[model samples]
Target: MGARCSKFSLCWWPSHIRSNRHDSSDVDEKDSLPGFIEYSLDQLRAATSGFSPDSIVSEHGEKAPNVVYRGKLEDDRWVAVKRFNKLAWPDSRQFLEEAQAVGQLRHMRLANLIGCCCQGEERLLVAEFMPNETLSKHLFHWENQPMKWAMRLRVALYLAQALEYCSSKGRVLYHDLNAYRILFDQDANPRLSCFGLMKNSRDGKSYSTNLAFTPPEYLRTGRVTAESVVYSFGTLLLDLLSGKHIPPSHALDLIKSKNFLMLMDSCLEGHFSNDDGTDLVRLASRCLQYEPRERPNAKSLVTALAPLQKETGAPSYVLMSIPQVSSSSKQTVPLTPLGEASYRRDLTAIHEILEKVGYKDDEGVANELSFQMWTNQLQETLNSKKQGDAAFRAKDLSTAIDCYTQFIDGGTMISPTVYARRCLCYLMNEMPQEALGDAMQAQSVSPDWPTAFYLQAAALFSLGMDDDARESLTDGASMEAKKHRN
Candidate 1:
């Protein structure tokens, strides 16, 4: 993951901001990150509806360095797919090298990479979907209630930690650490985008769009170092404090004259303590220092913010009194542990009911009876699962589905993830009824699995059961929230 942090983050910022700047876009891809998958272009196209316009997720729309699209895999898992412009990487190997490097990073405060696709002219990077949207939306474009002081402090701390983690891993050049690069997870925690690290392009251009957002040194030297990242971080601090894009120079002027009240966001009135605000102001001032060496390192920034971290049991959404997740399907529901044994019992009950009233296919032996031969059956099932996974990665839906069915038909093991994957494939094939059945089977296997409910919701929606789909979506969302809360 650290390798990914160094690669993708470097590619992220300058790529987005480049206009007349010196291009510096070469990526060193010697490092290997664990658990990163190589996705086929067809799979990405299927996931993102052929890179349709409706899937655009970037703030600047299609005109940016890379376009982002929201997508869902065959497993009902949501992801954000970033596709670089055609000219960004003329060499396919260069693009893959950059992507492979970025795909290695994984951190709680950073969006984790799911996979990458490098086919012909296409260079795509897939990462975990953040449902709560970007920090810019919640701050500047705030529609709901204003963000609370505690939540802001939390966001600051989380961003600092993310930067600290990246810097510690030798990924110190975060090209643009702005509000747009900060996203909120399902739990409403702030996640620093790995996309801020912009790699030097082949054309020698270093930066792009919105020159006002660029650090002074970047404009002068056309290069970024560790200290340059601190400058961007300082600019971000200003954004958080003012709830607007105040120039760093202007912000420094305000800070010098003890005119913090004027610099602070009016919407945050009465929420923060005077001392805390002053402390943050001071820190931001230090970060905005003209001389690169005068700026505090990410580690030092984290240390300074340590005392300001408020200890409260309240989640971010609650503290701000504003919904974090954008989904209308969100629900408030408490959760508790349902042991594995209980889940197995549920699966047995469901199987009995399904056999009695639900659809049934001829398979000679009972699933329950099949489990007695666990030793050989489990191994065979695992092998079939591997084949299914490989087929799924290759975008061979029919073959993948067949493989999964073979695994499930064995019935020696209960894997909700497998059921969910097959369920999604069924949905993709326009077999909503089968998808719904698999979703139910998944729930029976692992009743606490949030994704099973979501798959049920998707299947229901396809079948025109709008109200039921809404209910299922709500249940899934609630379960997801519960998982995060725990």
Candidate 2:
């Protein structure tokens, strides 16, 4: 008997699977993608701690058809370990094929597959764990403040781009798409789950999917096509518009009557302009059209929502930091320096916020720091930067790294020059991974700086990504040339 047919009823024996990163170039073109890892059963069991109950993450708890567990690999990376029901994937090879196909999909808006384990009858998939949780949690059952209007618009664009990317890759049939499948990454950006593609092949029954969110065609025909995915995307748009889960038919009625105000989430009362609201509502209305052929494709949807993206350069966390409306009134609560730092991740913004709302004592006194203490800390950060600059000039790589790291960790106002200088330090220290992270962060803070790209190329080259490094170097050179030309 094959591993898939091994005797195990209902429950899958927890496998101890070891994860190994597989290079794309080494993969047989017919089998798997570059990053796909096939873990040993031992590693999987160890990572999930014998698949403990604590690992289960689904709202249905452990009672759901398939259970998802949060696990940590030996590399210290967090991942979601989803163990599928035996019946769902009776053929292990089929599951692997589909998984490998989805694994090849790489998009900023999509959660890429990390690895999988297939030992005996156990069929498990591992994916990057999103720290910010799901869209459904933030929308209907918000714990913190409501998601901002700008953030919602950004989410819409992101989801659209994800679908567009998947469809372009020929993985057209996305079964039972919903907000729950969309997770928020570390930066508060939305990432569509790769598991969304690995669901049971189109059958009449839609298991565990919210009926209200399901497209009418799926309910009637018991099949999913490319067009059917559009219908599901339309429902997701409706969810963004109304925080509550309103059925497509009912939402259509609200749209037809031009009672969009009633359809809009009460928490988003003043944040959005009427025109923007109307535009999104109109787009949703088109998406919810009964006939699959009548619904717009993901490409068109992206095009339509492109204009609604107001803050293209704003970090996702910063967008979410905007004060949320409640009871038809907008509120602006001043944030603490650390709170601002946590959201904006921009040193300049953090410093400005700190200055505007200076350090406070227990009684909320302004300028809590005495002159000497404040000056000492500020001078320390500046001195570190200056030392780092001096060391870099002298090619003292180790000293440059130490000073740059101190300056960055000191939490002073962020300077692009300092980050660029530190990134070079990291590269020279033979820490390409750290160098890449700093280079990317620098780009995030000062997007147009070609020096960031130049550093990124060096880091990539050091990391053994020759082609990618060359591309980055080319981009940096071109940007620098353009800048000089102007």
Candidate 3:
């Protein structure tokens, strides 16, 4: 269970544009919040391919209490879906109310809440998807070079602006604020996740990280104040400076000892001036003060960091080396017949091809059992295959998957075709991750099989890994050409 915020006043627009008088231009109450949508469960399911495991983008994966999934809308707009656990927000009405409050907020510095769903016992929130991933991934466990000093400073400033905006909108508290809560948009600019603006549960447990990272006041009061958010922001500042999670106390000690240079990330060397480094360190120390009242507000934070910002003219994507693309842009790639079918997810075409191929390539792969006592086991395994094939032909995908599972578990036969068929079944059922596993299994059973690669491309396409899908499609075409020449 997590924390829940108190109900607050709602205004659709910023304070500057807010109007107290009703106008004829307001066509509908729902339309008042321009981009906010109340999505149906079925719509979300289709978007994320029935919430496939491969769609999960949260830091903790499926194991997280509330899982975040990357999904594309019917309009092809990418989104992040946060599915809260059953215990979170037991009262559906309260969940909707909170979602509405957060949904009204739209800020470039924030990963704005796009919509929410409250069907039955399920509680979910949807927001604009940030494709570049989270600060935790880039700062703490980056695969490429560590985040640049310019980008780091930009992230801090953007986050502060997000907080200030939320505060102005009367949504002040942010639960479990951490590196994971800061996401990089498609343009590589950092935006604070709106998910943190909503509470995880009603249990008064505001923080979810290690106790060391939790604000000391929260440890004692079991609550989070607006000031508590500033403390977490301090921790984030420390993360940017050190590229590590240094406990607040440890960070403050180093700051007090005049060990500011030691507190900075070694990777940041030659990238920032000593003065800039000292300024950020000093700001972090002020935010980490023992007295909550002494901490700076979000506005002050923005003011302090504004002058320290570097590379003011450069776009974030350039600094991060993330490819920039227009929203309407599409990748152009030549595809083979099967590859084209996969790209379009044309199940009818895919089915016809699989039916034509049948199990010709899998013949004689099964080992014959020498013992007569195991004869019944072999018969059962063969029976499962027959049932699976029959179900697959009839397009009873669930039944086909069950029968295929039984055959795979039997271990008496090795049929690449069975894996390929099951892979198609999983795809038709909108379970791309499972389909991917089956496709990989098919490849291991018969490495040169073009069908396996084609199936892989289909699953990858469904999961929105377009670049990988293109490569797989090319491989499948190459293998098909080699087979034709043979």
Candidate 4:
């Protein structure tokens, strides 16, 4: 007879079997590459406040055709928006295909692509924002102490891993893999920019920097390949070794003359041993080999540098001396009932408050509809609100959302309370972006309503936006106190 199955037996399965299942699921998810989104142009515009000048984060000025802006999504998540010029990608389909391909890549070593936008005569790509800035600023023009030797080694290894992962996924061509393309995340870990994965333009020049830094093969063929990327990586290796950007040709000459000390950065003295220096220099020489086929692959580079890693147990933030707050440092603040629910992100308590308040706050708000239009649609709009209120009280979120959307689209009347109720419904359904939009709409309809700010705070907190949520909560508290005084 077959073995009998029981709950106890299910829980007592072999550890290796469970481990293998988990690993297989991870590989499947990575290969499938799900979760990439296509954002609307209006959404992107609102995120950047109509692409304001102050939001510009790209090193290139705003006049540059391809400019990157830092923006906050409706969900309160910060993102980097790269807007390409109109003529940059005239073929919208091709631009979208390339972005989709890059968006499929998800890795911790990369500033992974989040989404893209392709509207009429407009093309944009959205990526996870890196707040700390680029490798160029920190390495060459550091305001604080120079990047330590361990951090430099970590950057090299992390970059190699990024390239190796990309190559494994059949994305080997990286245009202009330089210090500027490398960025530091909030934790100060190095990440390769996904923007470099896509070509700038169909007929545009491949290399943006000086021709002296270009690979010999690229110069001859007028095209970049996997080997060309390896060549650029070698130049970056040289940059990390030296405090400044030295021409690759001159650096190779120094390497050939056995002047290892000359190639080393003065700031890195007393940090790395002679053996480590010699090993890195030899690796850089192999990467910069004249023959394209003779260069070591990314996997080999990882192997060569694995044993050279320093401070293996130390966190990147600590090694880089970047300030980070610990959980223990956070203090709890006393809050009113509504404030307490928002602070704790209690969706049910918020729903209860919405039901209790009802449309009492919306009283005396004027409607600008003409008599004829009001007579035509007033009953229909009122019916939609009545149904939405019933669904909201019944805790039927989907029905409530549908009814509220109907009432909103009717255009005969405006109700901030209805928007707030729909905002809570969206939150309970795990749609924070839509919830945030509704909350903002509520504030626009009734700017002084403290409940609008409270709902906004709840939605922001749900999106992991602690700082913005706290500010919104404070605003709500102040408004409530002011109303009481009146």
Candidate 5:
């Protein structure tokens, strides 16, 4: 969660607004938040042509997708579709969870939540669709370029105002305020969306919840404080100002450079206003302070950007440098106590989550079983790479074999999980042939792992291929030695 502040008290948000004419049931009791519309699952399915893959609007690829379905309401108004991945999906309980937590805002800078659908096993949410996608798509790319200086502030002000409104009027925290989530309407107004990552202090834990947007204190303590949000907002401001992803891991090193120009989106083509951008740079720097106390509150952040709102016009986004992630650099955190799942870089864990959701509507029983098995295989692949002691690591091989056999039955698209664990388990069982076969498979999946090499060597040794075993053993030993050094 981006929001985390227990010491700083947030004031009434809608500091500059009037109430919506929509129904009151949707508003928060404390602040009378904005109203929302609702839609049924049947209506959404029809609009999306039965929720086909072609209807997908924005995808984070393979995993978290923002599938868009074009549908008309009973009254004939067109609505945009949002088919969320299962983790971010709202069941009946989560529907109100988001609305109550952060969906009550009525601002030009924020998107309106229309309604949602939660059929027996399917889940989807709906919001007023902004024709233009996220500012991120343009601002963070090189070939696409950056927005004009004046335009950057315009977007920044609108977002600051929205953030201010959330803090003051709604009394909620938008724990995830990344550049990728803000949407631009037809008229170029930024409508904030996706409160699926929000947390409510009124719920009483007093700590923020979203991790990518949170600081260490919030992570160390299970408190959802308002200050945490201030920190997150600061990070957002920094991203808007600098035009780069402020990874908490590299935040310190980047800050040490004090190179605001390096941080600013280079795509702006040198169009930013001199004084205004400087001020924004300073404010953004303050918001991302390592010390929570050093960060400004929501009111201060809004006040800092107030002057820049005066120099606005057609919207343009800043072009910041995009961070490059190695193909295999993705992390794998255990989704939950076997109840939930999240995205991973490799093909692993994709099926476990599908099984958890368990589609029952139209698919055949055998297909369902095969799907479940494939998902199980993905989970096994994930578990194989997790951090554990050598003793505990031994069990991962056997577990992976079970998972691989299930998917290798030729019922799924994902690759088999058999090869990676073959050597380890074969070594355990003294079966060189099975070990060699699996070692080859493991190399095909991820050649970066030294385990596959070591296992192949061990298999060769058992097969009496002394020269091959010696060379492989040396390579494997070197890799293991490097691993130990790290």
Candidate 6:
């Protein structure tokens, strides 16, 4: 099974040095964590005239991401107040933690974290309001009015520098580095914001995510190393260059073909000069390197982005560059009817949320459509695979993984099947570092699948752990008759 499974994108059991990059710790608690803007819910109400809709400076229509409030701080500086409605409460603690961190770490490129209000089950974060909105707005907001590459480069520099500051402060992880999180200043400099999910290790595991901005390691393991952040930075660069959310495709293959220049954002078609675009692309590629150790840190990122700043005077945005391959390669994946049920169930949950939000409003429809389009795209990808293969295919690793997740999530998948499918996904997703997670997950649900150990060993090897993989492979080799049967 191990020999059959190895591929260009083999799962490697990765290194383990957990950093609760995005989760909060209780060592200091809310009290010891200083720098509170110290205002009651009532004061906040007065600032924004009782959270009036008219006070809203900007709302993009997403029911959850929407920030509703208009307010003035006591010092007379205008501010934008973002309040978390009941729907976002589950992620609210993140907001409070960020409010504390960013509020204290002041910089010209950063918004003044005025303070926050956590009261009566209400959550609100206050920051100096930038009237201009996010950098993403000007770049991809409209194809006709794309931002000049110069501006994006400047934004990248600003982001890198800000992250450098955060990273230097002993240890702090700015978890969300997407375009939406970057608010622009009057002069067009970008300040990282929306940091409710920033990770600062104190005690216990405190962060979890599968955001595209994140590295596969964090998705598989609940930890944040600076290298993972660099990986995310690369993706952001790609977005900046492309002015679109480029999906995970065969990027590594593109780079290998030396045609990575073609992957430049369509908006920069004519603007890219010889050897110029290549500079930024190279920077992006470096950040996207699979091995976290191989990637640069924010400090190095600052150096990488500096050239563009010198060339253009402003920063250019880059989309998150990734090793451009589908999460699947030539690795076998098993499909079971149980996985289909979980997928349907996950869809139902999404649909139910839409219903609760009364998806009749234009914004609601837009957000729902965006989400459905994503799901539809996934379905189309899966359908394309199912049409070609029946039981298992080496190339269907990621697709099968998704299929199985849907099944398991739907609560219909049996024990061994769940592990079997998950093992495939974890391996292909470049998370060999976490095959054992599913081992535990599967073991909790059911036991007696020796195949898991074999799969785990492969995952371990992918991360360059030959000894572990060899040991597990020996245990999981199964009988020669069972193998030759294939």
Which has the greatest lDDT?
Answer: 4
What TM-score would candidate 3 get against the native? 0.63
Instruction: Provide the lDDT at 467 for model 3.
Output: 60
lDDT at 115, model 5: 65
Instruction: After superposing candidate 4 on the true structure, give the runs of residues whose Cα lies further than 4 Å from its correct spot.
Output: 1-34, 59-64, 200-204, 325-486
TM-score (all chains, Cα) for each model: 0.60, 0.59, 0.63, 0.62, 0.51, 0.51
Say which prediction, candidate 2 or candidate 6, comes out ahead on TM-score.
Answer: 2
RMSD of model 3, in Å?
15.3
Ranking under lDDT, best-scoring first? 4, 3, 2, 1, 6, 5
- Give per-residue CA lDDT, model 3, range 307-399, as digits (tens): 887887777866885533221222112234566577567777899889887889786575666576266687898889999999999999999
On TM-score, the candidate that comes out on top is 3
TM-score of 6: 0.51
Q: Candidate 4: TM-score?
A: 0.62
Off by over 4 Å in 1: 1-34, 59-65, 201-208, 320-486
lDDT of 2 by residue, 133-221 (tens): 68998788764478888888888888887888777778777766888899976556787898878756322244345676677777888
Query: Going through the candidates in order, what is the number of backbone clashes in each?
Result: 24, 15, 1, 0, 35, 50
Q: Write the per-residue lDDT of candidate 4 for residues 261-342, one digit (tens) a residue.
A: 9999998889999999999988999989999999999888777877788886676766775422111211111134677578
Whole-model Cα lDDT per candidate?
0.66, 0.66, 0.78, 0.79, 0.50, 0.53
- What ranges in model 3 sit over 4 Å off? 1-34, 59-64, 200-204, 325-486
How many pairs in model 6 have backbone atoms within 3 A of each other, for residues 3 or more apart or on separate chains, i.e. clashes? Answer: 50
Expressed as tens digits, the lDDT of each residue in 1-486 for candidate 5 is 111111112121113323222122223332322256455778887766677765555655443444566544544344567665565534557655665444445555566665666666555666665545577754575242455555566666666666666666655466445676777653345556744334431222332234555765677775555667667666666667667766644554555676556566666645766666667767766776767788787667667776666433222311121111111211111112111111111112323322333322112222233666666654554443332212223445455455544434443332313343434455555577776777666554544444445455556667776445444434443444344335
Output candidate 4 Cα RMSD: 17.4
